[model samples]
Target: MSSSTSSSEPTAAWARFLRLLLLFAAVPAAIAYAFIALVDPWGMLPLSLPLRRETVTTNQRFSYPMIAQDPRFDSVVVGTSTSRLLRPAQLDELFGARFANLSMNSGTAWEQAQLLALFTRRHPAPRVVMVGLDKEWCESGPLRRLTPRPFPEWMYGGNPWRGYGEILNPFAAEEAGKQALAMLRLARPRYGRDGYADFLPNDARYDAARAAQSLVPPPAAPAAADPAFEFPQHALLAERLAALPAVTRAVLFFVPYHVSLQPRPGTLDEQRMEACRAAITRIAKARPGTALADFMIPSPITREDTHYWDPQHYRIGIAERLARGLAAAAEGHPSAEGDYVLLVPPVGH
Candidate 1:
């Protein structure tokens, strides 16, 4: 009886050992498969490759290294693609300070505010944050189209690991995966050498060339005064502006839109625009160190569709003018000198 019992015990132990081995092996395999599927390795993976000759041919000149290398940027331009025309180099030249354009396509006020918070956490708070405001940004709607895919949070929020990778291998696996997916989704254009050049013009000569052709026009008055319009983002703008660190100087610029597209009487556009302007005015007046440079007036260049890539965004030439104006505004204002923390007032008053 004792011998029979011992044999049965050995057999049971063997079966239990096998089950444990299988469980461990299955876990890793499942995890790997899930990562590959969500990352869509083959389809969106290639965008992670660093700047190569072949890759540069098609893309204008977008290099992650270019942004990562410039840590001394004391001035940052924030906004959607409409503000893309303002080159960091020009601002540096004009202000005798380092600057970088952190603008992205279809960027919203909320996104900009988030980015500002992120920027402050890492590098020294920029002396001047040139925030580009447009009527579209004031629209009260979810920014569904601007949603970026889930990436390492640090990618946008300034995580050290991602920041290191961004500097070392700007075309790392994750970025490539995100860019690839963006391409498949038709969200962003494929990368090429010219990609950077296309957006970041090498010189101001293009503006001169376009101006000589009689393509640009003089500045005109505001399209119309529709006071009933409400700026949907008023509360949000005030909140974010107030939250900025006291030391960082904030300057708001109202980007010009085509007069032809101005909202008609009693239309949603007019109402929204009016609300945004009023909200902006209120914030500008109340904030101790904050100021506004309203440049929404129609310009000769703005009148031409060619001057703008779309209804709201201006061409690179127009962007240069905006940059110059921003520089002038910054220089003209003495209030920008000291550190000022932007605090949110109590909800009711």
Candidate 2:
């Protein structure tokens, strides 16, 4: 009887140890999950909990998907760094539609397509899809389609189940925690709700010598063919938007690159720019009502060094002018003579 009692004691102790181990592991796991569900930064869960919007971290890969899915905005601004200057509120007043700028750094054409696809799929058809046409829009071949980083396919897919992994991720969790803490203290967000923050100094100081240096391309044989470029996708973008039920306006504006940035006439760069513009123009003419505002052509705005800080990026004032001009053109009203030429269909074609 004594031997049996000792053996039973060992068995009971082992069971107790196993239970303790399970409890220890379960506690932290449960706590983590609870925190994630409560914070819900990625909007993966259906809880509709209010986020600390004041703590707007610049997480475009995550934030953009949320914005695109949101039903509040009826228009989207898609482009690269150059497009960020166009304020959404200003655009809203100009175009008579709620707009959200989804532009990011080095945003490629393919990335724009994915973003547009995501926006159109999850939310109601947008009334307008304004594309800021840049050199990236004219890219062709494998290199042209590739973005610097892979777009988060899972996030863009609009599948809540698939998003759990991103939602509960360590990085996401850390950001969520920070956001919660910041909310308690009323901290300001890194980026605005419009997803814009002026990265450059507002002062547009003119230095012609400095600007001219950027104009010179790398040494290459004069006979060497210009890098391959194609604009079919840009045209396709217009066509696709025009096909959508709610899409009444599809505006493609050539961002106002300064004069130094414009290639010299009869040069390969000039030829390439014309080719791209021609392709886009053809599409605009065919579609009718699609506004083609060309700023690439040497104009008053382009020639003015005061309008641009760098060779390419113009200042906010230029963006304001563009918004007003493009808006007027879209509405069939004549825009004031300025840096850009607005050609609404048959008139320009």
Candidate 3:
């Protein structure tokens, strides 16, 4: 009987230990879940916590879609950091339609494609779409994903259930807390209403030497029968744009990159860019009401370093000019010389 009692004593002790362990684990988890449910960062839960009117502070990959799908916006500007300076309000006024700038920093072509697809697939198709084409979209690797930091697919995907798990993440929780504080007026919004964030100072100075250094010719490559230009991703972009109905005006404009970003006038890189441009031109021709505004061509804006904050990014003023020029081109009006060439399809195509 004594031996049996001792054995049972150990069993009871183990049972108590298990209960304590479960409580310890369950309590914190319950608290965390409760917190996440309350926060509901990605709007996955039923709790509609008044998240601040976030513009720039939020991860654009996650936030842009939410705003784009709001149905209030009928026009959208999609591109990389080069396109972020564009104000949605400006586009709205220019085109006389509600607009949202869905550009992200280093936003990959695949990512942009996904966002565009998501936007167009909605019940009411978008009225206008402006794609800010750049090297990333024109270069190879259609299947290639975003690098350095992968785009969060769960947040962008149609499944709301998966988003609950996303908000439970530590990083997302931190963002939720920031949003909560901002909503409560404890913090300020990180960006303005139009999703324009000025990362560079307005008074940024240009150094001639620095610009010269950036212009150093790249090492020569072995001569080929034709310049090695691979742009399968651009084809995908064309396909998506073509899928849009004739009512939608799709504008594909090459960002006016600084001379440094562009290849030397007659080099192999120039050849590659030309090939990409030709391919895009073909796509534009195939689709009715689609226009290709070739700002990638030689231009005063592309030549002047003073007009740019960096070799790749132009100033906000340039963005304004580009916006005005695009608006003018869309209306069949003349714009500033040497800025862009507006290519429209032949009449009655």
**Where is model 2 more than 4 Å wrong at Cα?**
1-26, 51-55, 143-146, 202-232, 235-239, 332-338, 343-349
Give the Å error, residue 93, model 2.
2.1
| Cα lDDT for residue 263, candidate 1 | 51
Which 10 residues in a row give candidate 2 its minimum summed lDDT?
215-224
TM-score of each: 0.58, 0.80, 0.89
Q: What is the overall TM-score of model 3 with all chains considered together?
A: 0.89
Q: What are the per-residue Cα lDDT tens digits for candidate 3 across 207-250?
A: 55664566543564433466566787876787787778778877
Rank all candidate structures by their TM-score, best first, as comma-separated numbers.
Answer: 3, 2, 1
Give a tens-digit lDDT track for model 1, residues 1-349.
Answer: 9999999998999999999999998897566444433443222222333322222112112232234224556767667766766777777788676766666566656666555555554455566667888754677555433345222334344344334333223244444445445546634443321112245445443464453344333343444454444444566667766766666567777776665555545555556666666667678666656657666655564465556544665667666766666665654432142111122221221
Better of 2 and 3 by lDDT: 3
lDDT of each: 0.54, 0.70, 0.72
Question: Looking at model 1, which ten-residue stretch has the lowest summed lDDT?
Answer: 340-349
Tens-digit per-residue lDDT, 50-167, candidate 2: 7544324464655676677777888888888888888988998877788888887787777777787877776556778788888787664444554556466776666666655555
Worst 10 residues of 3 by lDDT: 215-224
- What would you estimate as the lDDT of candidate 1? 0.54
Q: Which order, best to worst by lDDT?
A: 3, 2, 1
